[model samples]
Target: MKGRTTAWLRKKAKRGFRGYPIATVAFYGPTGDFATKVVASIFPDEGSDPAAMERWFTQDTDVRTDAEIGEQVIAFVRGHAALSIVVTDGIIGCPHEEGIDYPDGTSCPKCPNWAGRDRWTGERVH
Candidate 1:
């Protein structure tokens, strides 16, 4: 497989192409326990454009140190067939940051620090 360029991936991510099927990817341990998860959107391949698809895969897929773990994710996705199209790749997920509320899990409104606006921007937190 050819190497994935971080610069290309970053560019796609900036454009907001998350993960395939537009869902969260939760990785699991060998014992079938939860390990970590990414909330990236996957970008589908462009017709007759293998290069575009390859770029998307390089951007969306996580570069796991453990080959086994990586394979497991592929198997899981294939088994579930949770794909909208032939998923190549794109942005994997956003990095977890403090004071930033992701759309998943707890909503910003319910958070204790929620003051009807974003703490940093003073805009509506929602």
Candidate 2:
């Protein structure tokens, strides 16, 4: 049940671009090893930005393995009647938002592990 929801979402994403109303899913955390937050957005069409977005957070559990959170994510996508789903394969970055959570040019004080590292690859950056 833990991995099942994640698998289902991934399966939907693997179906490729079916049509309009695409759902995008991304995970974030303090470190690349554990996802503490998940953000899901719905794009109505190719040229349009996301019309709807939702975020879930967990401090003690990984959002990837949280059954309830996964269910909510599935429901959100379905509720939007999304024809396509795109999910990130790994944690992309910190859960905090730049400019909103911290200054734009400064590293997130709450997520030092992600500082000076590539968000997608989690590799140290020069």
Which one is best on TM-score? 2
Q: Model 1 TM-score?
A: 0.25
* C-alpha local distance difference test of each model: 0.33, 0.92
Model 1: CA > 4 A from native: 1-62, 83-93, 97-126
Name every residue pair that clashes in candidate 2.
none
Error of 1 at 63 (Å): 3.5
The TM-score obtained by model 2 is: 0.96
Per-residue CA lDDT of candidate 1, range 22-110, in tens? 32243211111222332223333433222111111222334433344445444444444334323233222223333564455553343
* Per-prediction CA RMSD (Å): 12.3, 1.1
